[model samples]
Target: MKVDALYREQEQLAKKAVFYDAFGKLDSIAGIDCSYYGDLIIGGAVVIDLNTLEPVEKAHTILKLDFPYIPGLLAYREAKAMISACRKLKSDVDVLMIDGFGTNHPRRCGIATQIGLQLEMPTIGVGKSFLCGNIRDDGYVYQGAERTGKLIYSSRSKKPVYVSPGHRISLDTSVELVEKCMKSDRIPEPTRLAHEYVTGVKNTLK
Candidate 1:
């Protein structure tokens, strides 16, 4: 098998998408996002101080996408550029918030999970919509028989965000961490900032 093929197989083995039920401090938080311009991908990441919720460092990169876009296999299409951009960060971050699914995916591995596995760091997925699973009556618990994730209605007037553990955390812990990163919106601050940061830099694309 080719090296990339072997790594994909390795990714499959690295994922532990199930709930872990634990919590930890997030002194430094990083968010990741990507945008596309034609056949090019513009990936961005931002790291912020938890106390101030302000970006202390940021990185962005442009790359020609080699993989075709696939629904559940978004990691293969986007993770490389995202990881490259994230690596440009000079400081360490306690957690990474990604704009994709985590365990909410069919294989129990979303883009966030793949990135987390590669980075070997704590990560959380904050998706705008569910790729899989059904929300319970409480609207907080999302489950599909054995697999589960969380949906948070941060504000009554706003729709809930699909939350899942990417790696190094549990469903409950994912929620707790998101709440700490929340400002006045349903979207987590780290991911929100990352999206804005990436989109802004994407203007250079052809």
Candidate 2:
């Protein structure tokens, strides 16, 4: 994919994000994760009921890579497969959690933000490693000089994961929802289920 094209899409995505929802009531949470098998991408989407915190439905898809595995341009490489899997969900996704950065990107339009904007739904980025955000004394995350997201320190986590608003959600609310869905020390339950599903599928195919 062309850098110019991604930039163009990022520009448009930013504009759409301005119209995002930050206070929508959430009932169901959807999480997405992508794994690779050589040159192929396998994506999984899992929808979990917030009240029960158990996966209600799961979907997966495999696709040929269309873009390079660049650090910041992962949305271009992975979003299509994820969207395909997300389409299989029977329940409505009130909030989405993705295995990547949200506003914590160079362009503030990472994969989570891109897909969230595309779906016009509330989304949060749940990254295990630090991407491009700094944590403050009070735990606010800043990218460069502007505040973008926050860090969630799990009792069982060796390192904190970055949490940021992807689309149609506030940074605070993003953290709250992630904490609600978390059943592990490192990752949230919704995303953990999606990751396990994709990992199992990728291993089987390999």
Candidate 3:
């Protein structure tokens, strides 16, 4: 019954997400990721200057795992900590790049979508792996006939990353911005750094 309620909440929030670019300015972007250690989860957010690709601000929050790990309902388990980390950022990022799915999910509401809706901020989801949808010949992922996201290989020798609009952003813009933020790694810098940041925080406990 609780899971059913969560699914309904996702459906409602997904409807509220704007599938177009609704934000002004493109100066900075924040990357959000969460790391785990035992029963603790550490959420990290790192804001980077777009032109320079240098981190301007970063924040993190450590919390106990209050929610169980569910496959399709990750937002319910990790979004609270990620939101706390994002709220701690003093820098006004133009968009958030989260390491999860967005509209690519079965319910069209992934962790990235949930965070963007809850925060009312522009966001993109840069997923390391596919959660749903099948890749068509054009390299775009589709849920049945509707396009969900795109798959692009940041490194030709490595696996591709999935790019999708989370909220207040368009699929084209999401792909463009993620390409700009890409460094030598397959993961975009904002999310890649945030992953490192949170991992480092988790390591300190060991």
User: How large is the C-alpha RMSD of every model relative to the true structure?
Assistant: 3.2, 1.8, 1.0
**Of candidates 2 and 1, the better by lDDT:** 2
TM values, all candidates: 0.87, 0.92, 0.97
lDDT string, candidate 2, 82-168, tens digits:
989998787888888999988887788888889987887778899887777667898878877877878887778777778888888
Compared with the true structure, model 2 gives a TM-score of 0.92
Ranking by lDDT: 3, 2, 1
- Stretches off by above 4 angstroms in model 1 are 1-11, 14-24
lDDT of 3 by residue, 60-91 (tens): 99999999988889988899999999999998
Model 3 clash count equals: 0
Identify the runs in model 3 with alpha carbons over 4 angstroms from their true place. none
Give me the displacement of residue 197 in model 3, in angstroms: 0.4
Model 3 weakest 10-residue run by lDDT: 151-160
Reference-based TM-score, model 3: 0.97
* Model 1 weakest lDDT span, ten residues long: 14-23
Tens-digit per-residue lDDT, 99-205, candidate 1: 99877776677888888888877888889986787767765545556545777766532787888888887777788878778888778889989999888888755
Q: Which one wins on TM-score?
A: 3
Q: What is the lDDT of candidate 3?
A: 0.91
